[model samples]
Target: MRKILTPLLTILHRNTCFSVRLAAMALIATLPGATLAQGLFSPAITVNGDAITGYELEQRALLLRVLNAPGNTPELARKALIEDKLKLQAAKAAGIELTPEELKAGMDEFAGRANMSTDALLQALAQENISRQTLRDFVKVNLLWRNYVTARFGARARPTDAEVDRAMGRGGASGGIQVLLSEVIIPITPQTAAQVEALADRIAQVKGYDAFSAAATQYSASNSRADGGRLGWMPLTRLPAPLQSVILGLKKGEVTAPLALPNAVALFQMRGIRETGGSDPSYAKIDYASYLIPGGRSPEALATAQRIIDSTDTCDDLYGIAKDQPPQVLERNERAPRDIPRDVALELSKLDTDETSTALTRNNGQTLVLLMLCGRTAQSIAEASRDQIGNALIEQRLQSFSASQIEQLRADAQILER
Candidate 1:
């Protein structure tokens, strides 16, 4: 299954654990000679009085590998199995039990996430030497824990009107985070990789806007380098989703750790951040194009880019410049913000409609990228309602309770690794 990369590369991969089944299968199904590792049936771990067999540990580790879960697979498998055992124990103590219909529904639901029937899923797993019981047990514990949480915390987790309004950005007041940032992007070719990495790390530690701005002016490969890499105040929602957390975590004047991007490294200094009046708008789609040119960041490539910039007024104009080139050299796409590649989204955030940037490269720095923003389709918030927002808040609160409950169980239970 681990060799299944090529055929399944086009299938959508959901990052969350529950939704990754199809993607995981896609990853594992293509392996030509892969075989499961077997182990003795002695206990590998114990939670309270329940034993986790060595065979079960191996099964889970294989599953985690298929899912491409990060870190040591065996360790992660052990931790997860321990948590599941605790969760089931807590569910049992709370008198949670599923009917046959409910268990079937849970199995169907889990299989549905991968667009497979329960039988189909079981057959697929069987082909990989994973038992049907393993799938049933995994689904059973999750269902039990969910029922336990809902029964115990549902009533206490309801949100008030004010809380709902605040969450949905309709609090009848201007609210949402906005940030001012200074950036430094250093191109990293194999020849300059070590130097660029060291430079980026050093820049990350530079204190104050002036110092950071100086570094940007001296070394940044971005257009904003001329303005000391200063960006105007931007709504947090307008940034790439991954970058939002990094920005939120910074204090004014603190820099983010050097973020790796295609052919470059980026560092940002937080100039200022504040809660601004107004809802932070979401976009339904972003339309953009990228034209690849030969000779990355070389004098000729830069001159060509500048010439193209002067001649082109919109994304459509790029078609003329790339008229004779291979189709793959030029790309135009309209994607939901969440679906855009992180590096592309980051660059798009810094542009207005029809604006172009040459800040990115491709083909391992052998080609320069000419990127243009076509336009953004703003997502309508007309359907957002009090009830929808309130229910979401309640779910969040319940999840918090669920996490704490598990922690309490783990603390009170005797868990030992054999």
Candidate 2:
């Protein structure tokens, strides 16, 4: 039978990036040469009908090294190889596949945690003498194993509407506590302290928070300065003690005077509030179609995105683009804000019937999303939100179910040591 080969994904470990597959390909080639001197390279174990050989084991070991196996730990390496082999076998058995986009997403996510761009990420590994092909293989195998588990056991993967309602009841959802606030930070260099303090004192005199916020935007040194120092809302518990007290003391349109700090004079204004279920639309769900671009976005990249936005206004047009981009489209049944990325949720909260949202976002250094809130339901409050009692029970069931699946995989596999 022919050897089964597939596209590889690089295994991006926390400490090191290793290529698992290109090394495997290299070994496959040199094994033919080595066999001239020795006998046949023996298979370590038989996976289904296929054999996993010592050469494959060594290659995977090279990829797994960043996991910090001890110096005398050939045994652990051997166990890892078997686990990997079985995982790939299980994935194929379960018919799980990773699309190129998912592979990219996984790669981008790994790179982001390391504070590197995807391209920079590949190069860093190459500098350490690891090939991109090897890294890709590592990522692909792990992803396969992950999908296999989920396909077999993820019916309990997500939360239901009723459960989200209960969370809202407990003030756990985004709007219930977190308030996105903008800030203008005036840096107080030793020389600038007096000037900044004077500015801070004047800021307190401004009548409305908006006037103060506008001035801060013009002069504050913080990142939120451009947006009028608007910090997204947060629970009081999350804030620094002093900052919390000031904001809590103010009302919807209030402004605070500049306060002193070691490094800066910070001024604050209350932009608005983050509210949960109330007298507004009783229940709503937004069906969104997204195009995920991974890696930190650049001005040029955003410019290109702005162009894409200018030309395509409808979801159908976005779909036309997705056909070529190999995009990911998910049609979630009426989702709560807590059920989705906070930014997307906030956008959904602002929509009117038959209306579309302005361009909005969800960002991790790796994942760049362009979301369109397609449709929503503003139903009667009588059935406002679903019953939380059953929903909470369902969530509990799902968690228990996932734990059981992980345990089963642990028990079912014949994981061996060297």
Candidate 3:
């Protein structure tokens, strides 16, 4: 869920049957409200007025487990549950509300999103072995919290005409398209319709796939968002056979129609193509240059960077800058596992120096002149793009707002977590 801020200290009352069941369990078990002791761990510690039983944590953790959540750990799961409880408590203080039907609707969407039938979803929940009532309580809190946010925060809900106008003017990516991609992998299962399509979706994102550019414009996490579906140049073999065929057949700039596969649909656009060469970290040795002007004159930095780009035909002048001013060069470097994020290293394998990349971009009061395609290798991957950074910032703000609101509620909360 996206982050949210409260105008009137609103809480999203997302109560679920889980909270109710926990309460019921507390009553039936005759334990302190904070005693979280359950079936796991040594024994649960009872918190303020609630029971932070091991049983309870395990029950909540099971929800995450059932979904095969990535990189999950017991402690992380515990922290997440604590955060959820905090949210629930906050919602209650603010008098948030949710109906059973709304909860069911939300559950249905969640279940469907995971590609599970309602019955299957239930069965999975049952495997958690937490009472069905427990699930309901969880749903209850979530709904209530959302309601509270909309209500108490309703006054602050105004997105405003000026904001809207600003968004419009600044929203569209002037140069590129942002892409979002969802993939259902077989996890190596034999090619079934669902499995095949899932892989298809994933494959389609590999540069030259039919749907690569189009769907990516909507799904990709990139700075080139305003452009419909465009990506930087890509090597031929980076894609599978089906995708490679479409890309190889393309002109310098062409849109490929959606290609049907065993299970997926693909659409794409060829933004550009360029030369690549032999290197360990292929992009580490870059040929592209940047326009770095000092921060004394902000616009000049940008202008000078652009001027370097506009005046010079190539990165030939990069050395001149290093000669004239204090300069730093960032080389594409390779590292083994533990040295870099696995995903980043993988992306780096596909790029090279001399190629134009939206990577290596930043403007922190200093002039930025990025040289393209400095070098390449099967090395470290880059971090998020400018657009990715923006989206992330938005999400972070929402969470921070929610956290602050929760803190205010905590002051009045008769809350305890073990």
Candidate 4:
């Protein structure tokens, strides 16, 4: 009887211990914030068996919004995360991993963009419920991917001298003169003409390319505002007849007197001049059109522009998009490169016939100018700097290769959305 009772007590104690452990787990599941944490940290999507949690998506969207990135925040965040996963996987496969020190340095560099120290940035993010880990993760992936691409593809990404020369607009048999010019175009209406002229006069008085660049950033209406108004070497023949004498007359670091335009006043700062060998036809005239959209850089406006880009293969297709709008909305004209406005010419330089640029803005950022390249009539030109040409070619090739590699990675990835 004593043996039976002892065995029974031991069995009861073991059963009680198991019951207590199960009860505690059930209590934890029902507790405040516990279930919420589980849901937030749970996998939202799986890329090649690796999970991207809901919390990560929320953090990324918040980060993009803070950084003023364009487009839909959530959608963009999701897309970015998917790409990040792919990049990270590739980096791992290449045996390229970011060290802890390297990650901290990357975090520091990112904080510097906001003029803050790493600790300060972390504190600021914490106040907004963004974890420091989120920033670290973002920087880590970017740094690793960039390093990986350079290491893996840098050797094959170099551009030849001939490619660079052509990119620099020196690909023809005839040699020509090219001028390196910085420009500022201030849009003016009748009511604001006096103010525009006064501003232009002040800018002209300010000496040096740096001063001119500051003025361009503060006041220029062109899309090249972000570039400090620097227009890389353009053939002298590409400029308008009226502006040719003005640009050539100015000494280096000197600004042009205000030149009046139909809707704006223009100023040019001569940076330098050079002659290149091998004459490619300098464009004597360009035929193009401009269509205006109401919101300058808004997502909706950009989406519409993208739709137009996708639907239209040539400049003629733009006429349909402009149908039922104002007549001036689709203005077509043939003008020399210089007469086309420096910003417009810069955009045109990047495009082939029938291509379009959504780079320029007007009416002080309230309007988007869709510039369509209709055609270019080329004239004979001189040879350009082979070194400069080579550098430009190499840069372009690297960019193209980087993009192609990323697309290929995406194609090969096995992504599963949870």
At residue 264, candidate 2 shows an lDDT of 53
Better of 3 and 4 by TM-score: 4
What's the C-alpha lDDT at position 245 in model 3? Answer: 61
TM-score of 1: 0.50
**Local accuracy by lDDT, each model:** 0.78, 0.53, 0.44, 0.70
Question: How well does candidate 3 match the true structure, expressed as C-alpha RMSD?
Answer: 21.9
lDDT of 3 by residue, 217-314 (tens): 55432324335344344444334434556565666445555454221234445555544444212121212334445542345654555555455433
Backbone clash numbers for all candidates listed: 5, 29, 104, 21
Best by lDDT: 1
The 10-residue segment of model 3 with minimum total lDDT is 1-10
Please provide TM-scores, in order, for all candidate models, with all chains considered together: 0.50, 0.34, 0.36, 0.43
* Native-structure RMSD, model 4: 24.7
lDDT value, residue 299 of candidate 2: 55
Over the stretch 227-319, how does candidate 2's per-residue lDDT look in tens digits?
A: 666655444433443465687777766766666543456666676665564333234344555555543244554565556667776555766
Q: Best by TM-score, which number?
A: 1
Ranking by lDDT: 1, 4, 2, 3
Clash pairs, candidate 1, are 1-28, 1-29, 2-28, 174-277, 174-278
